[model samples]
Target: MEQQKFEKMYLMQTVQKTIVILRAFTKEQPKLSLTELNKKTGIGLSSLQRFVATLVYEGFLIRDDRTKQYQLGLSLIHLGKLVEEESSIITIAQPILQQLNKATKESISMSIIDGNERRCIMNIESSYALSARNHVGDTSPLYAGASAKSLLAFLPQEEIDQYLDEVAMEHVTENTVVDREQLLEQLQEIRKQQYVFTRAERIIGACSFSTAIISNGRPVASIAIIIPEARFDEEQFDELRELILHAKFDIEKQLNK
Candidate 1:
């Protein structure tokens, strides 16, 4: 019985160390030599080699002979896509997006912050002949659009300040908030209101209203309705905002469940 417990503990330690080694690679450093991986992961060369060999055999990592470095293997891509397809938020939002699009006849988009950028992970295009369009993989500055603002507004003050300080505010359109102080104030207001409405902030002639979906006490994703500015109506805006907010709330409940 004592021997069995010791072996189980050793196996758990090995699993934890393997996870540390795997996490050492990132987008900025996709490939790493054994020496670098050792330094980054704090794992000794001999043990690292054994783990790396097993990982490569299992198709979780690949080695580049010329560079004598390892990179994430292709198998991860398939696993990542599977995770996205089955993600609770995506699964819940899929049917909701279709329903929202049918009711509003407007483009619906869902985005999450990817580093300093907002990545549109899902988009349901409007049925109207002339409508605003954002593709699933489209990326935009986090400071420039309603979809991003909803998420950004809820971040910690220090993070917001750091982001604003680090990111150069580009004038994507005439209506975009180019002044730092004004943008800061707007972010505060957005946090207070729990929503954001932007007109041509990122794309000319396009307007959007967005709200964040909170889960695990943080903004996990955002949903937005984008339409041509010419067709935007002040009276309809309130109604649409409520609908979007309701959808966000429902999705949040499912995510929390």
Candidate 2:
């Protein structure tokens, strides 16, 4: 092949294979064996072996000797942030998120939309572990999760349609919504309340509350809290919702001026 064509070929394969490898890291299977990766990705064993080896060498994945699996590595984390937005939203939100966590005694997080997915941008962990599986940089579908749903409730209907068209609904738990009409109705209610709350929707035995951070006529991000079902009651939800709305107001106020 000519040099130009070879460069293009390499770029295309690199893009395709990189995504395939990255998609292997899920909340449940953050660690995976080469056999598991091959099974999950449907890639040929030899190709997967070569690619996995290269990824480990390049510092994108690491081998866990005790678990006999591979997980994301620090190199990826370092590179991921460097390539991400200039300055960190996490740094900006950390203080406020920590205050919210202290006030609610819940696991607080701030998430923003990133390429059709909602990415957790910051977190303030609770004394009790709440949604330990998700932290900064964790991605979730645009339709599910309280933070995502908070964004969805305020997002343009066209984007919502595009997301529904492009992504299939995955049943994270029994409470996850699949019916379009029902989801829309729920979204309407959330809009009316200016916040979202769900129980066992994205993760079993966990519930979340979220409010959108609207700026310049668009949802710029969301603030959410993860609370275990047993620890919080409806009255407690009311208090947290008020705090989230206040946080949204503060963010918007800062962005506007």
Q: Alpha carbon lDDT of residue 52, candidate 1?
A: 96
lDDT of each residue in 1-257, candidate 2, tens digit only: 59999999988997798779878899888999988998888888888888888888988899988887999988888767644532344455667777777787778888888888989877777877544325889998878878888988888888778888888787777888988878889888888989988888887888888898776577777888888887778877667878888877876665566
- The lDDT for every candidate, in the order shown, is 0.89, 0.80
Worst 10 residues of 1 by lDDT: 77-86
Stretches off by above 4 angstroms in model 1 are 1-86
Using lDDT, give the best candidate's number: 1
Clashes of 1: 0
Considering only N, C-alpha and C atoms within 3 Å, which residue pairs clash in candidate 2? none
True-structure RMSD, every candidate = 13.8, 14.8
The TM-score obtained by model 2 is 0.65
